[model samples]
Target: MKLPRSIRVIERGWLSANNIVLEERSEAVVVDSGYVAHAPQTLALLERALAGKKLARLVNTHCHSDHMGGNAAIQKKFGCAISIPQGEAPAIDNWDEQQLILAVADQRAQAFSYDDTFRDGDVLQMGGLDWQVIAAPGHDTHAVMFHSPEARVLISGDALWENGFGVVFPQLFGRETALAETRATLEAVGRLDVDVVIPGHGPPFGDAGAALERAFHRLEGYEQDIARLARHCAKVMLSFSLLEKRSMPLAELPAYVARVPILAELNSRYLRMTHAAMAEWLVNELERAGAAGRREGLLLARGE
Candidate 1:
């Protein structure tokens, strides 16, 4: 489906979330800056897209490291006002690494402040369109999605991807409501009149019906077996680390998993495997999924 001319999506790889630009007459608004490691690239892309037009604001669907990693850089370059979900205000204001899952997952994002906060039911004007803020609480408890009813477009962050939504981190952390919340989020999205989806990690897709069905199937599997969910989270965390670092020494995998708080916690709670075993299992799983490769005593992130 063709997106509105005012909307532009800067598709990115797994390490970073895609950047969405809403160009107005004299100014523009950006949604979700990419990962911190790609801040320079994000700025370069924005410079080209904006073409001297003012970037009036930076908004986030959630507070994940990958999604908001380049916030500081964008603010520094464009001096745009940053706005985030109201639920995330406390965490972002304090720069709580644990609450934001940065230190917990061994991810990094430069701390940046927000000028305002938007909550569910709020309407934002961007690119001459009215986008309604809808609470999407599965991926991140406080996450929200923006939908433009007139444009029939949904900016679904990690909440609802084309294949499946993001890993339900709250479930891994023993939040009993996570699975239900995920299901509810999907139901909410299903109620929207969305003809196009701008997801956080992948290209914009028009098959919203098919995507929701797949997401429900994935959620059903997780709901039936929490252990499976734990394992999936572990593999994702490890893969993200590898993506950021490019490659890790084979010999250090075990220690690396043990040091990362989230990985270590997952191993302790659900997997209950020796650190070495957990590391080996993660590498094997990632390899089987084509997310990583081993060569010359190093585990390298493959195919992004």
Candidate 2:
């Protein structure tokens, strides 16, 4: 969906994030090329917008597989210089596939090279405009937001959203301060004159203040949920056993909580977290929240 003036939003569904195509002086720059599946469409959108003009630069908010999945593709197609967030540089430089890959285990992410780095307060001249870099790191430590202060526009990369924000899986990898950091990050983003917000996920919003407010509230609930689940005993084993039995059929409602790695490891140690445990916990959680009903050894999720 093309926005007014120089910004266009190219939706990539699940693989790549929605591409933000910025235009300037008939030349162009694309923000967040998205996943590998999105490279062709991203390139196509850029070609259509630029009409064969040079794609001046390729910038990433961070180096997640979803956001930078098309980085190599765009670099190959346009021969553009790729600049990502500074925190993302080392991770991308080494390319730990599992670390880079979205929702995956241990597989090292394929290594890709970036030409430069983006830091907070940096200005990127694109689409006949200058976009100021706004580093916000609730989702990924390295993630950065782009702002067109003149337009009161912000491209928030998984930091702020209409309803909620990204998961805090990185904390499991030893970053204890991640949640605290996320809270502080939100504080910074709230200070911006963001009349419009284009998040890494979901539709763009005109009232970013309202969006941020909703996200903040959701974050409180989400954090409480995560913490609550973490403290429970045998939760991981229960989740796994239940998921393994009925996971194939119930794809939409994820039975497994991948972010809770500690619980996953615990499942391996104590086999008490059995199928029955999972079934009980799931049913109990649902029952507690009034979102599910138990009937004949089966639990049904609530209909919206």
**lDDT of each candidate versus the true structure:** 0.93, 0.65
TM-score of 1: 0.98
Clash totals for all models, in order? 0, 9
On residues 1-304, what C-alpha lDDT tens digit does candidate 1 reach at each position?
A: 9899999999998899999999989999999998999999999999999999999999999999999999999999999999999999999989988889998899999999899999999999988899999999987889999999999999999999999998886345546698899999999999999999999989999999999999999999988899989888888899998999999998998999899999988888899999999989988999999998999999999986
Candidate 2, pairs of clashing residues? 16-35, 23-127, 24-127, 24-128, 96-109, 97-108, 97-109, 98-107, 238-278
Top candidate by lDDT:
1
- Show model 1 residue runs off by greater than 4 Å: 170-174
RMSD in angstroms, candidate 2?
6.3
Candidate 2: how many backbone clashes? 9
- lDDT per residue for candidate 2 within 1-304, as digits (tens), equals 2244888777555335778888776577888877555567767876776677788788888877668877887888889888888887777767765456433431112346888887988998867777899777766777888888887888887787776665554335555566666787788878888778887767787877677688677667646665442323333233323322332223322344323344443343433355445445555765575555555546554432
Instruction: At residue 27, give the lDDT of candidate 2.
Output: 74
What are the models' TM-scores?
Answer: 0.98, 0.75
